[model samples]
Target: MSFEELPHQADVRVRVRAEDCNVLFAEAARAMFSIMYVTCDEGEIERRVSVTSDDMQSLLIDFLSELLFVSEVDRVVFSSFDVVITGTSLTATARGEPFNPAKHLGGMEVKGVSYSGLTITRDGEGFCSEILFDV
Candidate 1:
């Protein structure tokens, strides 16, 4: 699985590819948080996240949005994730550390995850999604 940043006029756009739903969500989270901070601190801090939605599209949005919220409130930056999706709900274990401005190189400030122009396509190979982050 992999994710890459795309050019957007007003926000950050990312294209993520994964072999399945689980990895797709995890990679998306990595991309989102990585955009905010390139690297976190030394100590590992674990956080469990759960999000529910009406559909796959909404599920993706909610999952990333929840991660963003958690990071903001806890004052941490996540580097890894183990995500599992059951039906329209997702449960994830996120690992990171407290934000250190002196060490972690910061990137753009992402405000929210956007639905406009978002698309997820699955063929015989795997899942590919384009997600827009409102910055």
Candidate 2:
């Protein structure tokens, strides 16, 4: 799985490519956290998250949104995800630790995931997704 930051006018955009749906979702989460400069070196906590949407794109948005909410409320940053996607539903175990200001450098504050320019499609034998984040 791999992801790269794309140029955006006011927000942050990321393009991700993976071997399948599950890896795509995991890579997207990593890209989002990377944008925020969040790193979980020594995981001290684990959270299970599940989300269902009408489609894969929506499911991805909801999944990431849940992570963002958890980060905000629990004051933690997740760096690893074991994501499973079946149809329009997603379930995953996220691992991370509490956000320590001294260790985790704060980057751009992502407000929410956006639907603009969002795309998820099959590319050859794998899958690719593009997401825009509101910063």
Candidate 3:
């Protein structure tokens, strides 16, 4: 799994490449957390997330949005993700610890995930996706 931040006017953009759909989802979550400067001490919390959508794009959006909500509500930052995708549904196991402002350096605040410039495609034996985040 790999991802790189792309230039955007005001929001944050990222391009993620992975060996398959599941890896792609996990990497995208990692990339978002990295961008937000979210750091966790250890896996003190584990949450399971399940979402269903009409298509891959919607599924990705819903998955990320759910993570953002979890971060805000639980006051934690996720560091690990185990994801399984089947058709338009996704189930994930997320692991992290409670957010400690004293220990973690905060980065940019992402307002939400955006659909602008979103794309997912097959690349060789892998997959690549581009996502835009509203900051």
Candidate 4:
């Protein structure tokens, strides 16, 4: 799995590619969190999250949005994700510790995930999606 940041006029945009949908979702999580804050490899804390949407695009947005809410409320940033997608429902295990100002600071402040320019497609290289995070 891999992700890269794309230049944008405002906000942050990323394109994540993975071997499958499950991994794609997980990478998306990593991409979003990485953009928001710098975190260590020590994912000592774990959190389980579940979300459902009517479609794939909405599912991705909702999943990240929920994670963003949790991060803000609990003062944490997840470093890794194990995600499973069954139709429109998603269940994930997010692993990371509480926010450490020294480690988790100095990154973009993501306001929210945006649907604009959001696209998911499958090719021989597996699955890929471009997500826009509202900053």
Candidate 5:
């Protein structure tokens, strides 16, 4: 697996390309958000993940979904990304935070990152489980 950080307008863009799907998934998951058990090809296939209107959950979900959507829609697997977290919030084109895809293309379908096991610790970092569509 290989990873690189590409330049972007706003938000974080991670590009990852791995020979092993599992390892690729792990790296991508780690980059997108902190996670415990990276989903496997045999586990309960996750196709979508949602976030609450409040808190970091929204930003997290939006960020991961865009990756997956990009992978599905575009033929590119992101090996790295450029992340920009400002004032604990962001702005995007559509609903939720906006990200400029033209700047960073992490080609990978990431259905959604869930809030089920999400734990925003006091230190301001935590873990969560995300659902990937076809990965």
Candidate 6:
């Protein structure tokens, strides 16, 4: 897995493979380390989990919710994520600035993943997918 910040944009680029969660999580953490917008104790976060679902929409919701749950509990906001899907499961890892309630700027609130603008289909090699977040 790998992530890089776009120099001119406010977005991050994420690439990840589905075989392992540890590698993906580490890459996400590294990407978060590069953010200049927030602060927190790097040692506080200690657990990671891989979420699985039958479809892309559900997988996306599950993945983002995991991140949101951590942020709300730890008061951190992640800025980047990489997701990979295999079989009926999804592996996602994320990175973001540490949570600082004192210096806090609001982060995005993601509702559950929606079927709107969501698509899943098979091409020659394998399945291809795209989804739009509610933001």
What lDDT does the true structure give each of the candidates? 0.88, 0.89, 0.89, 0.89, 0.39, 0.47
Model 2 CA deviation exceeding 4 Å by range: none
- Model 4, 24: alpha-carbon shift in Å? 0.4
Residue 110 displacement in candidate 3 (angstroms): 1.1
TM-score of each: 0.93, 0.94, 0.94, 0.95, 0.39, 0.47
Model 2, 1-135: lDDT tens digits are: 399988988999999999999999998998998888655564879999999999888899999999999888998888888999888998998888788888888687889999999999998999999999998
On TM-score, the candidate that comes out on top is 4
Q: Candidate 6: where is the Cα deviation over 4 Å? A: 1-47, 82-84, 106-108, 120-132
Worst 10 residues of 6 by lDDT: 10-19
Name the 10 consecutive residues with the lowest summed lDDT in model 2. Answer: 35-44
- Native-referenced Cα lDDT, model 2: 0.89
Give the range of the ten consecutive residues with the poorest summed lDDT in model 3: 35-44
Compared with the true structure, model 1 gives a TM-score of 0.93
Q: Where is model 4 more than 4 Å wrong at Cα?
A: none
Name the lDDT value of residue 117 in candidate 3.
84
RMSD of each: 1.6, 1.3, 1.3, 1.2, 14.4, 6.8
Q: Cα miss at 28, model 5 (Å)? A: 6.1
Q: For residues 79-135, what per-residue lDDT tens digits would candidate 1 score against the true structure?
A: 889999999999999999898778776577889999998998994699989999987
Name every residue pair that clashes in candidate 2. none
CA displacement after TM-score superposition, residue 13 of candidate 3 (Å): 0.6
Candidate 4: lDDT of 30? 92
Residue-level lDDT tens digits of model 3 in 1-135: 399988888888999999999999999999988888655545679999999999999999999999999988988888889999999999999988888787668677778988878999998999999999987
lDDT of 5 by residue, 1-135 (tens): 344444434323445554433343345544553221122222222223232335554555555566556534543333333333343343322111222355333434334555444333232132223333222
